[model samples]
Target: MAALILDPLAALGRATLAACRTIGDVTLFALEAVSHLVRPPFYGRLFWRAFVEIAWFSLPVVALTAVFTGMVLALQSYTGFARFNAQSTIASVVVISLTRELGPVLAALMVAGRIGASFAAEIGTMRVTDQIDALTTLSTNPMKYLVAPRLLAAVIALPLLVLVADVLGVMGGWLIGTYKLGFVSAAYLKSTFDYLEADDVISGLVKAAVFGFVIALMGTWCGYRSKGGAQGVGGATTTAVVTSSILILALDYVLTEAFFAQ
Candidate 1:
């Protein structure tokens, strides 16, 4: 009986220790990447390439997601508020929802799916192929050359993407409200503008920056540490996506509370 109890306790202790070690490793890796970012011989070309790749290539999906989300939100709001004769508030609801929450969260998730998996796969390939080792052998810091640019690019790109998504999402709501729900275009615009404070947009942008960091950190962390060969790369890709998504959601609640709680 004592052996059974002790065995489970020991297993739990081991798991806890392993988790702590993983967190430490990730923190150290992030710190090292950040340190390299401020050092001499900054890689401007690499940064530019990463900037274009992250920001430009990501716009289409983000726009589509924003438009469709706004449409659905407007539709749902109409459905619910019609019973209470509060339909005029639909415009306000859609704007606040997009600017304060959904736009940032959804845009980050899309980027994590697109960029995070790519990061893991690309770096994991480099690691498994001995390129990373070759870089170190040649006196090049892989973290500086590879990780920092990507991190910086993502931090810049995501907020821009979220900003665009915010506009497009609001546009989508406006379209549905005016065309389908018998709302006056002018009134909807006025309501949306009136209800939108600068902080609402700023809050989402802040969350976007943090989410961007999380996405890049998880992606690079998983890739940098990925083992084995192709199968390991695939696993790292999956892990990066899943972990980034979960962190985005968990952090969203924490940030919302920090910003909005009483």
Candidate 2:
């Protein structure tokens, strides 16, 4: 009996140590990336390309998700409020929910799914193909040249995407309320504006920025450390998406609590 108890305790201790080591590695990688970011030899062209790739290419999906989410929220909220004759609050509910939570969270998740996987696959391939090695031979810092630009671009673009998402989401609620829910456009707009505060919008954008950093960091770190060959690249790509998505969700809750804590 004592042996069994000790074995389980030892297993738990080992698992805890492994978790701590993984966290340490991720933190170390992030620190290195940040350190390289402030050094000389900035890559403007790479940064521009990353900005366009991560921001411009990502707009359509973000817009679509925001609009649909708003519409659905308006519909569901109207249904619940109608029973209590509180349908006038539909606009407020839609706006607050979208701006405070749905818009940023959904947009981040979408970007992580699309851009994170691409980052991992691209970087992992470079690692496997010796391109990263060639860069080092030429006295180039791979983290500075490759990772910093992507990280910077993600930080800059995600907030803009979230802003657009907020607008489109509100518009979606407007359309749904006016047409499907028999709400007057003027009343809907008034309620939205009256109830939605600047802090709510700012809080959501802050969450977007944090989520963007986590997504890019996780993707680049996974890709940078990837091994093997084509299969390794593929695995890294999958891991990037899965890990980024999970982190986005977990951080979303943490941020929400921090922002809204009483």
TM-score of 1: 0.98
- For model 2, what is the C-alpha lDDT against the true structure? 0.93
Clashing pairs in 1: none
Residue 4 lDDT in candidate 2: 90
Residue 104's lDDT within candidate 2 is 88
Per-residue CA lDDT of model 2 for 87-173, tens digit only, reads 999999999999889988999999999899989988999999999999999999999998999998998899999999999999999
Report the C-alpha lDDT of model 1 over 88-126, residue by residue, as the tens digit: 999999999999999999999999999999999999999
Q: Return the lDDT, model 1, position 5.
A: 96
Candidate 1 wrongly placed segments (more than 4 Å)? none
Give TM per candidate.
0.98, 0.96
Clashes of 1: 0
